[model samples]
Target: MYKLLFAGLASFVLAGCSDQSWRTTDIGDIMPPLDFTLTNEEGETVHGEDYRGKATLVYFGYTFCPDVCPITLSRLGDTIRDLDDETRDNIQVLFISVDPSRDTPEVLKRYTDAFGPEFIGLSGEQAEIDAVTNRYRIAYEYGEENENGDYLVTHSSAVFAFDREGQAQFLMRDSHPVSDAEADIKRLASQGG
Candidate 1:
């Protein structure tokens, strides 16, 4: 599953190579427009339309992830920090927990707060999560639980970027540099759609 995700991303990147304007893979045509309904950190139901006027980045992972989750969010925080105040305010990072069984709204709030004010955590019932993941072609699965009832979730690490109008724009892989992300986000913010 992971390999399939990687291959898809690679093809997207390669297809975008002819366009030198974007720093990351241009997915404006291939990816779907942003759409989902999930519970926010404040335990309120929110839809993707609520974020319509901002350049949004959505990442699927779990709060309990040992390494990748924290590092990815932290790097995103860094990317936002590098932007000017106005551009920073115009961007949002949505952290969607794939492991909703253990990540309640309160837990998600706490986990995302450490990243930055621009970061918001969201989760929902399994079906809602599955809908969003499937819409984006993201693949995630759980590992076998240990005696302690702890398990790991293996999920795609790509970050989906959407323009201010909720249009699909680009995709960022883990290998994409923060500098590139920052630039791409700034461009998205300026475009206002």
Candidate 2:
């Protein structure tokens, strides 16, 4: 069929890709490494490099994100549960706090633990948080208090998937279902451990 012929031609061209297509790939391309070190709930330092050699599900939001963070985290836990044990071991779930000003390690731990232990919660100082957020192109705005000094932060809701060696691969929007994420993980895991 015409479609099959076109696909074969596309594969042939991809095999000899040139300067024009250097940054694109059908399976997704490698993005810059995120070199950051933050303190986990256990008061231990964790670096981006420590998660190399496995697919990592990364999300940038606060524990206080009423709708987005909790849903996304829950979906991630569910997606992980749906995976086979080996795939689960090869992947890590990270919940990075955008509200470093208020999200302490304990708070993060508590909020994330309610979902699953496999989820790691990280928080740091303002500068450290800014650096990581910028590297991932995540936007967050906080401040302004209510009568009771309660505050709210508005941020982007996205689930970014990274391959081994710390390169970005895909991003799941707030509307993307857990099934979409599961398919992605299964495909990546198929490439071998």
Q: Who wins the lDDT comparison?
A: 1
* Model 1 deviation from the true structure expressed as Cα RMSD, one decimal place: 9.7
Candidate 2 lDDT tens digits, 40-131: 88868888898788877788888877787887788878877877887777787788898886788889888988887678899888888888
Mark the regions of model 1 whose C-alpha exceeds 4 Å error after superposition.
1-20
Index of the highest-TM-score prediction: 1
Evaluate residue 4 in candidate 2 and report its C-alpha lDDT on the 0 to 100 scale: 100
The backbone clash count of each candidate, in order, is 0, 0
Q: Give Cα-based local distance difference scores for all models.
A: 0.90, 0.76
Query: Which pairs clash in the backbone of model 1?
Result: none
Output the worst ten-in-a-row residue range by lDDT, candidate 2.
Answer: 18-27
Q: How good is model 1 by TM-score?
A: 0.87
TM for every model, in the order presented, reads 0.87, 0.81
Score residue 97 of candidate 2 by CA lDDT. Answer: 91
